[model samples]
Every structure is written in C-alpha cells, then in structure tokens.
Target: MQATLMIYDGTAAPDSEIPRTGGVPLAPEGFIWPLCGDCCGGPMQFFAHLPVEYGVLSVFLCQNNPGSCESWDATAGANRVFLFPPAGLVAVAVPESGVTLLPAVSAIKTQVVTLEPETGDDDELPPDAYDLARSGWEREPGEWFGKQREVLGSLGGSPSYLEDDRLPGCPSCSGTTEFAAHLEEGIDRQTAMNLGGQLGYVFVCRPCSEGAFLTD
Candidate 1:
C-alpha cells in the first residue's frame, strides 16, 4: 500500500505538511512559553531560520528549562511535525500511537530547494538516514534532545520548516553553526562577535558558552 505521507531526506517535505494556522507569524508570537522542550515554564522566543537546500528551518530553545521539554511539534494538516538530527534529512509521518512507533514516508534528502509555479516537479532525494534506529527507521546518535521531534520533511507546494536557534555544541566539531552577530567598537578598530551574554537565553551548547562574544 502507498504510504499516506512521504518523508524526504528528513529535509524536504511536501508543501501540505506545513501547519496553516493563521494569526501565527512564521514564528510563535507573544507566546508566554511557560514550558520549555522539557516542560519547564519559561519564555521561548523566535530564534533563527536554518536555510537548508530543501527548506527554511525554525528552531527554538528555553535556557530556563533543562532538557525537560525543549522540544517542538506542530500539525499543519494530517501530517505530524519533526526535525532531523543530521545536517540534512527529512521524513513523512506514519501511523503511530502511545506505544507504537510510527513509520515514515521517505528517508534521504533530494537536496531540492525550490517551490514556485514550476520546477516543483523536477528534483527529489531519497530518504537519507543520519544513522539508523527503531520504528520505520531513524537517524543515528540515538540520544536526541527529547524536546524536538526526531525528523521532519518538506514537500513541494508545502509550507517550509527547519532547525532554528540550534545550540552550538562545538563549532570546531560541527563545522559552521549559526550565531547572532554583534559589533564592537574600538578606538582604532571594530570587531564582530557572537552574542552570548544577553542572548545567552537563546541557543548554545555547553562548550560554545565558553567562547561566546555578546552583542551590543
């Protein structure tokens, strides 16, 4: 039988997967956010937009909450929402319940990032696994932040989704992680830095915290 939803390389999902909730900005607005991914009561704000080859990702975090509920989940239509752990991955939702782990549509990413009147029918990426896990299959590094959905995808003609405010664990290890920029003025020179202090409440792994440079 054909799967109801088709998961892309855990990256691109169909346009239909995006939640069409009105009155909601691309990001959650004025949300008191009493619960973090770990269910901690705190304020989670708009973080960042991860522009992948397939879609624009949105990630959120709450420093106040330990790892209790720093996760994110939204329903656009009949499809469930989630985020892939690897750099590029996407997947479609399947039948699931309290104890049953649902299966996914696709696994690898087509690395396709274009949705217009045309070019929509051109490219596609097979479901790419970051690693492998139980259920229909999962990316590697099993210990994922329970706060966020394991994987999510974007299909043509669907609202885009992505990873945002991703806390940098070790840029040296992860390569390039996005950060809020800050400009510092010196008598003879100016310097650009990563915002860490005031923005500390944002997203940054434990190590990145040591190398953070606050913004103005």
Candidate 2:
C-alpha cells in the first residue's frame, strides 16, 4: 500500500509552499478578487492555492452560468473558501477591467507508486487501497492513460481516503461534507475532465455554500 501523487505538468512556477491548483495567487499585494457569493455579480473561479499550516487556502468557483449555477449546492452560489495569513504573501491584483485567472500554472512532480497487488496467477486482489491504486493505473493503459490525463487538475493531496462513503452529502443540511477540491484530468486534451481514469471529488458544506461532485 503506497500513495503519493503530485504530478502536474502544464507549465510550472508554484511552490510558495506546496498545496496548489490553478496558479498565480499568493495574494496580498493588493489582493482583490473574491466576490461571488453565488454571483453577486461575477469574479469567482480561482479554484485553490492552499498553503496551510497557519494560512493560505484560497478557493473560488461560481463559473458564471455554468449549468444555471447552484454550483452543486453547498448553499447555492457556487463556491468560495479563503484563509490567507502567512503575513499575507503578495502579488495578485490586476483586474481593473477583466479577471478570471485559473489556467496557466502547473508543473509539480512527486510520484512514488508501489501499491502492488496483482502478481499473475490469475491475479484478483484489489478490493481496497483505492482499488489497489486503480489497479496500478490498469497496468499502463497506454502509458498510464497519458500520464493520468496530465495529472488532471488541482489535486494537491489527501485522496485515497478509500471511500469514506465515497464522500458526498450536505446538499443543504444533510451534513458530513468537506473535502473541497480535485477535479483533475485537464491540461487541454481538447477540454479534458473525463475522469474515466477516476478523480473528480469536490464535497463541501462551508456554511452551506453547498457543493458535491463525485467520480472516484
């Protein structure tokens, strides 16, 4: 049983302290761009930049009119999750006219696979450890499905919690929801996001900004 995957690769320049997703946003030089309490007008969709251990958690997602809003429901209004504080970092603030940054950063790497479980003899064990790491990426589905869809998008860590009931609830008050983000599978494979190789997961209930999305 092993699990340590952080293998982005759409570009680079992120490591102000691990926990990343889209890019550009160590916020505070003037920090401004967090107003989509469900489209109070616009400006939401930054989607993650974490830097925890005492600050920095930025996440947003209204997606304009993406499927008539409701983001998923967290409370309706889509998404938003701030936290800042490492002395407030800096830089992010240049939208006097247009703003929606979230597609220009990527290039992490930290593989460490070794969750084996199938060794011939008619192999057939995988029933846990996230299906034995998706059966070791299906034993190389044409190069791990194009490197697992270019390391999908926004997947810093904490997955393979191995079916915590598959995580999802709190459509309003059902409670028990808080995983946050990991939509992965996209770096432009023609608009990726298939997840056929598994990943999705977004859960949330932050006071009910409501949200849920599974794919495992």
For residues 103-196, write the lDDT of model 1, one tens digit per residue. Answer: 1212222232221121233465332222111113233347543311222322222111123343333323443333322111111111101122
User: All models: lDDT?
Assistant: 0.25, 0.53
Show model 2 residue runs off by greater than 4 Å.
1-42, 46-99, 104-135, 138-146, 149-159, 162-171, 174-182, 185-200, 204-209, 212-216
**Per-residue lDDT over 1-216 for candidate 2, one digit per residue giving the tens place of the 0 to 100 score:** 554454554465643445556665677666677655655467765645655344556656555666555444445555545556667477575344323555455544545556655564457533444335433543555564434544443332444543665566665677776664455655565433334555555555556544455454
Cα RMSD of predicted structure 2: 14.9
User: Best candidate, lDDT-wise?
Assistant: 2
Mark the regions of model 1 whose C-alpha exceeds 4 Å error after superposition: 1-34, 63-216
Best by TM-score: 2
TM-score of each: 0.20, 0.29
